[model samples]
Target chain A: MDLSGLFAQVLNGLQYGLLLFLISSGLTLIFGVMGVINLAHGSMFMIGAYLAYVIASLTGALWLALPLAVLGGLAMGAALEAGLFRRFYKREHLDQVLLTFALILLFEEARSAMLGNDFHAVPVPAILDFSVPVTAEFAYSAYRLAVLVVCLFVALLMFLGIERTRIGSAVRAAAEKPEMVDLLGLDARRIHLLVFAVGTALAMLAGALAAPLQSVYPNMGESFLIICFVVVVVGGVGSIAGAFWAALLIGLVDTLGKAYLPEIAGLVVYLLMAGVLLWRPSGLFAPGR
Target chain B: MTPPILEARGLQAGYGEGLVLRGVDIAVRPGEAIGLMGRNGMGKTTLIRTLLGQLPARAGQVLADGRDITREATFRRAQRGIAVVPEGRGVFASLSVMENLLLAARPDADGRTPWPLERVLTTFPRLAQRARNRGDQLSGGEQQMLAIGRALMTNPRLLILDEATEGLAPLLRDEIWRTIRTIREAGLACIVVDKTVGAVLSVVDRAEILVKGSLVWSGRPDALRADPELMHRHLGV
Candidate 1:
């Protein structure tokens, strides 16, 4: 590839990595602290994209739909936690997987029933429709850049929230030693609910941002979900920083591979993940030790 | 002079089909220390589980501060001033020492009894040096101290320590006993489970010995200490 092409591919990788980080961070948080393997997490992303599509169409402003989509995601996540995930907190991991997988089916069907199976588009705001010239003949879309900036901001906020605040301390405690968190007279169940909501909200935000870049459809989140798991696994389960770095790595590898390794692109990410596991079975950034 | 701070009446509990605690009854008065003694698999741990509501009491009552707490969740029971330093320390291996202590600290109504970071450090000086260390990073002795310190942070009316010093070195075990004495002297009701008959006899006011999931003997610690054969038969120590 030429210089400008390589630089463009690199930016694409960064943008994609940031989005993956947004989604995987929440998944890692829920899994690390609550130990709940929520297979339905991707469904929440799909719900966000659909919500953004509906809101943007109704309001005729993409920016106006962002917060609404996030709120919807939070509500859906909290409801799922209180009604379904809470019951499975102490159950086996296999059961949690099965239940959440069932939720994916339910979510897809519900979306179809409510929003129909037609593909939807989230138009970029008119002001951000143009591309910024990086070189004499090369450019990147302003909307995609905006998504990158917003994702980075949220990622920073999440890091601060988990590492600095009193609530974050409680979350870290609960994630590490749930029983001890209970012994402290804190309502761990409430903490779990909050974490689930926050995680879902982040996923929603990612979906909403990606709506303009990708078509909104019932199955849009499924492919992203698989890649997000790869992000989680390669980064190390439950490590936000790990997710951040791994997302970038995966983004670059996947983007560059797809750009260059047309025939073998599909095998590239899996090969990278297998190599990571071979070196560090747990992950590149396993949290506990 | 006052009603027992905690009591269990006719408590029966088990794991699966095998009964572990059969009609076990125990009580702890304010400012008193009681020791639970039994050989391996004699239901001492089971009794602790039933009392904490971690294991369901099939047919009995658990009361905290004269209030019926049989139906209360474990966290609710904790909110009502009951704290447990569980067996094996139960430290969150991934959490920092300060984080573990902070999680267990409860703010009093006036917020004066808060177990501040400094107070915890002072209580367990070892924790001070390793405040940023994860639970799994600490030695067995340090983890036990952290467990006790974590429970103390809750400002609980009743503290229960299950196997408080099971795997510690002799010197560390002595330090734990000294700390228990200090806590009891501070007027907190405590129930301790330990295999060291001598140390337990020295610290607790009363002792209960369990055999085959039944409390076969209950009396003043002196009464049991006077009969070494009793200790050997039931406690094997």
Candidate 2:
């Protein structure tokens, strides 16, 4: 492949990686802290895209739709936590998987009942609809580039929030020992609720961001959810930084592998996960856990 | 007419299908030190758990600072100035020692400065030296110190230490004991649970002995010390 082809692929990989990171970071936090393996996370992503489609069409303002989509996602997450997930916090992982899997089916059916089975699209804000030239014959969408920048900013913000803020410490501490966090005078239940809400919002944000780049459909989140599980496993269960790095690694591998090694592209990310697991057992960067 | 900072009467709790603490009673006034002694499986730790609301109290009451906290969640009890250095330390293994300490550092329940970070570091100098290390990386003794430091950082009105020096070396055990004494001198209510009855008895104002999940005896340390047979009858291995 030529340099421009490589450059375009790299951009594709990064943009895809950021999206995966946005979604998977939430998955990691929920699983790591609350010990819930939510099978419906991808459903939240699908819901985000669908919400953006609905809201943008109604308001004719992409900016307004995005925040509303996030708020919508947060409400959905809180509802899921209070209504269903809360009952399963102390249950076994097997039970959680089954419950969350049921949720995925429930959400998909709900979406179909509300919006029907037809595909939908989100409007690309007119300003970002332009493109920047990569090579003599190649150009990349400015919208995708903007996603890369926005996701990076969000990632940085999330990292600092968890690492530097008092609430962040409570989050980290709660994941380790929920009762112990209570012993420290912070309500573990409140932290769990907050984390579930945030995780859900992040998934929705990714969905909203990705809607302009792809067709929004009922099952669009299925593949991304699988990809997110891969990212979480390869990044370590509870580490956000791990998710960030692993998401990029998987994104680049999947994007470039499909381009250059089309014959075996489908197997590259799984292979990388296996290799990392064989080496570390845990993912590459979970510090003490 | 001030109530005890922590008072439990006929508190009953246990693991699923296996009762551990059967109607245990204990009390601690402000700035008082108490020793809890019992053999393995006798439910000393279970009593602590029930008192802190970590376990559901099957019967009886837990009053803290004159408030009945029997139905309160564990964290709410903690916010009311209940802190514990639980068995196994329960340190945040993924965080640095400093982070572990800071995670629980806040003003006491009354919003007064008590054991600040600087004070905790000064109290446990080894923790200061290893502040940058992760919880899992600390020596068992250091982890114990960090645990106590973490609890103290909360500036709790009542601090409970369960087997604070269980696996430490001789020197470290002494160091832990010394720190416990220092904390007592600093005027904090503390409950020290240890198998070494003599060490615990020496420091505490009052002592209680448990047998088969029931309190068999309780009194000032001098009364227990005066009767050597009491130790052999209740605490002897």
- The most accurate candidate by DockQ is 2
Write one digit per residue (lDDT tens) for candidate 2, span B1-237: 789998998888888898887888888999888899878888888898889888899888999888899998888888888889999999888788989988887897578977889999999899989988888898888888999999998888888999998988898899899999899889888899998888998899999898999999989999998888877888883
The C-alpha RMSD in Å for every predicted model, in order, reads 2.3, 2.2
Could you tell me the interface RMSD of model 1?
1.8
Name the weakest run of 10 consecutive residues (lDDT summed) in model 2 chain A: A60-69
Clashes of each: 1, 0
Q: Could you tell me which residue pairs clash in candidate 1?
A: A33-A175
User: Over the stretch B1-237, how does candidate 1's per-residue lDDT look in tens digits?
Assistant: 576778988888898898887887788987788888888888988888777777788888999877889878878878877889898888877678887787677864455674566776787899999999988899999999999998988888788999899899999999999988888887888888888888988988899888878888999988997898997888886
- Residue B216 lDDT in candidate 2: 91
Off by over 4 Å in 2: A135-138, A274-279
Q: Say which candidate scores most in lDDT.
A: 2
